[model samples]
Target: MTKPESAEQDHGYDVVISGASLAGSAAAILLARRGVRVALLERRSDPDAYKVLCTHSITANAYPVLDELGLIPAVEKTGAPHNDARWHTRWGWIEPKAAPRGPELPHAYNIRRSTLDPMIRSLAARTPGVDLLLGHQVTGLVREAGRTVGVRASAPQGEREIRAGLVVGADGKDSAVAKYAGVPTQRHENTRFGYLAHFRNLPLDGGIGQTWFLEPDMAYAFPNDDGVTVLAVLPDKKHLPAFREDLEGSFLSFIRALPEAPPIDGAERISKIIGTVDYPLISREPTAPGVALIGDAALTSDPLWGVGCGWALQSAQWLAEAVAPAATGRGDLDRSLALYARTHRRRLRGHQFLAVDYAKARPFNPGERLMFSAAARDASMARHMHLFASRLIGPMRFLSPVALAKATAVNIRHRGTAASARPRTHSEP
Candidate 1:
């Protein structure tokens, strides 16, 4: 794809992207690759803006997108390879090895947000036909005849108006673009709070990320490129106060209490503890006439699975592909935005629905119990669980009758064997 020629004047661009984070920058790169001019706006002046409160684990499914954008080599230089997943549950530790997939579909990558975000933003700036605007915060959307045409932004230079045929909202969970564009959003009340920090000297199994399902409360530790590791805890709302009082101490204690805890006991803290309270996972329709939303701005899934970064990049790619022809004047902008909206909803709604349902803090449903129990007992079941976790299969596949029946049979047989091995109880005289 050839790069588009830049507009001679500075008042407008082919597309105006609000928020220069992962999603926005990725969209800019994709648009530029397809010969579409883009103006990427970010509130922060620094090019190296970082999202401090993220786990930054990109699943294997996202690797193809990164490779297609020519970013895998650059990202791999700063990120650690993540290939295996170790689940610590009441039953036992279930380790799922990476499937023997080709290099195109390798395992996961664990890169700190501090490093990953900046790298992608820099690439966006360097891409031809992309105008990277920093330190500019958008305050309002410009509408022409009831359709979005541009944005009203405020920067140190003063207020300015930049017009574009298409406007994309990549601002984030508390997105101003969605609000100004009048896209209705429904929020699920997630009472879970998360606390995370980086540490050194933590003993982690090489190349594997570990998650402890401490029923009700969950903890995860992922090793990154540098000697640093990210440890996060998702605690019930009631226990939030203790975490707030002593952030570092409480975070360590929570992880240590897990059944097969990560070796944080001898670890030295490398960063200040960060906490998000009552962070509900939210989902919203991502488009309107001449406007669209991507990433967290579109749908906020539960962070428990570490899917935010991957989903953000993936959605950005989807939006860029869907809107390219319209931005180039070959197709209608409204139709393009509508198609992008439908595609986003179709790809994400089912996944988000199931995630939000499980976020309700209820005990595992029968299907979940059966699947996990089977994974604990058999390697093949573990591989199936991995495929589901990595999102290679849809929810329907995971919940299919055949899969459920196999899991149920495994669970029942195991229970029967345990029951037969137990000594019989006798009545006392």
Candidate 2:
């Protein structure tokens, strides 16, 4: 470990966060708001730089965090629509109708990362007590007596040592801080690969999102800001050879072949189709002495569910909430770190487990088949599924005895009339 005093300049703060992306920026902003000085570091030179290969769906479970950060209005100003998703299942469509009156139902948001990332980064930069260090790439960590003391960042001018009471690794799944700190990570293989591209003039109803659960394969159409629709396909590895032979042709054919497929032929392609064959599920123990990890740095779930963005924001909030009092000189930092770790696991571990299992691209289990088929036949069943898929409820509650019993009864009731009750194909009105 390098001595902190050897650097040309040593900056001190309550927290030094690596990577000024969603997790880093949100952590910095929330920590700074609680009277903690923060140094937000980003390797990217451009302030407007955004992640390109992302579905960019923020789940409804994180709306409270966005509201607390005073970002909802700004988010709306970007023309991001509240996304209500409809799923295509083997039984038929599970499209729940919205309640006509009373309190509004929860919904997720669909905004391209190109518009969302810069907006949040700028917000954090403008926040008081947050020193946004652009182009400062974290290269090493400063440790003393087995505790991470700070980070060594390489900047345009020279190497600078930043000392802080707590070091945060909000960088990404491939986190330098986690790597340098020797955090243990568990990797799970994803049997399905993904490909996506943006299009214009897509006539999906009310810009709502659509997902097709084709057993081992999946596809999605997310209508986003500025009249853009992102069409994506996640196919099992068995199709890899065909996709590798002709990327665009394979992607287009896959989407066009979906039951009640979207109007791909009618829409104009706006961006190059991006494909990624490998993105293993990653889960890391999120805390060490004087250190805490957030966002993809801590856990990278299957992209098939589009949980990364919301989890990034939610994890940042959890960390800041856990450590803010300690950083403000009012509590024990170690205890706070422990609390954050516990809370993180309690909230996300089950979800991550399910996501990793499904990432293998296996056929749905018996429970899934029962629940999905029942959902297609019953409105209440569909609503329950909507809540679960929107992430408003956890797997525990979603798979509870009550829900399963309800689903079983629904299936029994529809046994004879199920075919007649099935939703019309997407080609219908």
Candidate 3:
């Protein structure tokens, strides 16, 4: 690792990034690779600290970035499962089967945050030109002439002021940098509360991930590293009291009641049930002049889709790609910032819209019902659903005119068959 240049003495770094977790660290590494200096600040003193309340699923769409970062081999070595998902709907199971000679299906990874966070952080620390400053918490932003220029942080040594060409807030949803920068944000209510726990020896066929869309409620069993399975439930607020009364019991009951449920009862429970009763969906302006936000700081959509970790990686990549030329003194930083913001919004807006709408815990609308049922009955429809649900494609493509037509035709064909198969009661005696 290169010695971290004194940020204050070096006329400031190219970028000062808050939060040395997934987004922050990855941004630092990517920027440094593009010949820019970065100061990656993390509040936690412990290098091994990890986020406990995360789904920890990295969607397949993010694999390209991971491969570029030289992390896929390391991630696979951690025993994380390359997971394909199957959804249980009222109509039936919407599982996309691979064609015999077709290209390999896309798959995500299920790894615990405990292992992933520190791994990425360590990689960032070793990368040249990245100052992974642990135990440094951003207290405020440094603004000059109404533009954010850097950050004010409290370091283990003492209060430190780090100036930079750009400041990035990679901190979580409650981003102090965003707050201090006065970044415009939107918040939406999530009517569903969540609970999850880890278990050992859970019998899931082929270790494939399973999800149940029980109308207003949802449940999942995701096989993770080290032979552990994560069982999670997201129930509407109407069921909060029961969950609050018997958190473990209610969680288990809700999961066990699902069709083709995992053998949780027979499995050995490894972690206590963790519950999050209220989590607001948040979206912030991705960039402001010299300041940029990534990961949860930029957008905290519903976790039901398990897009957080993947988005964190991809957004960091996008920010680094957008600003690297500017940071390296080849372009205008403001234009770069605008590019980053535009790219971020373009890639995530549709996904966020759909996620926020469903976060209300509303029952399936006609469109949702039509699509989900069609997905269960038709392989091509199921493949499209799988791609969208995996965050591999945008909503526009998933709900394209062609997709809608195919779904309508499949449903109508099924409807006709059902009517023809119906038995008639004796009439006109």
The clash count of every prediction, one per candidate, is: 0, 0, 0
**lDDT rank, highest first?**
3, 2, 1
Clashing pairs in 2: none
**Which scores higher on lDDT, 2 or 3?**
3
RMSD of 3: 3.1
What lDDT score belongs to each candidate, Candidate 1 first? Answer: 0.81, 0.87, 0.88
Give lDDT tens digits, candidate 2, residues 1-429: 112222355445899999888898888888989988898888888889999888878988889888878899988998888878889988889887655563466876899999989988998988888888887889999999999989988977788888998999998989999999999989999999999999998878555899999989999999898889889999999999999999989999998899988888988999999979999999999899989999999999988898899999999999999999998789999999999999899999999999988998998888888889888888878888878877778899999999999998887767645457886354210
Task: Give the per-residue lDDT of model 1 (tens digit) for 1-429.
Answer: 112222224544899999888899999999888888898988888888888888778876677778877888887777566645788776677777544662232466888888889888899988988888887789999999999999988877777788899898999999998999999988997767888889888878654788877666778988887868888898877887787788778887888887767778788988888868877888888888878899999998888888888888888889888889889898887788788888888767878888898787666666676788788877767777887777667788887898888887877777777668885463111
lDDT of 3 by residue, 173-201 (tens): 99999999889889999999999999998
Worst 10 residues of 2 by lDDT: 1-10
Clashing pairs in 3: none
| Model 2 TM-score on a 0 to 1 scale | 0.94
> Candidate 2 or 3, higher TM-score?
3
Model 3 spans with C-alpha error above 4 angstroms: 1-11, 423-429
- TM-scores of the models, in the given order? 0.93, 0.94, 0.96
Best of the two (1, 2) by lDDT: 2
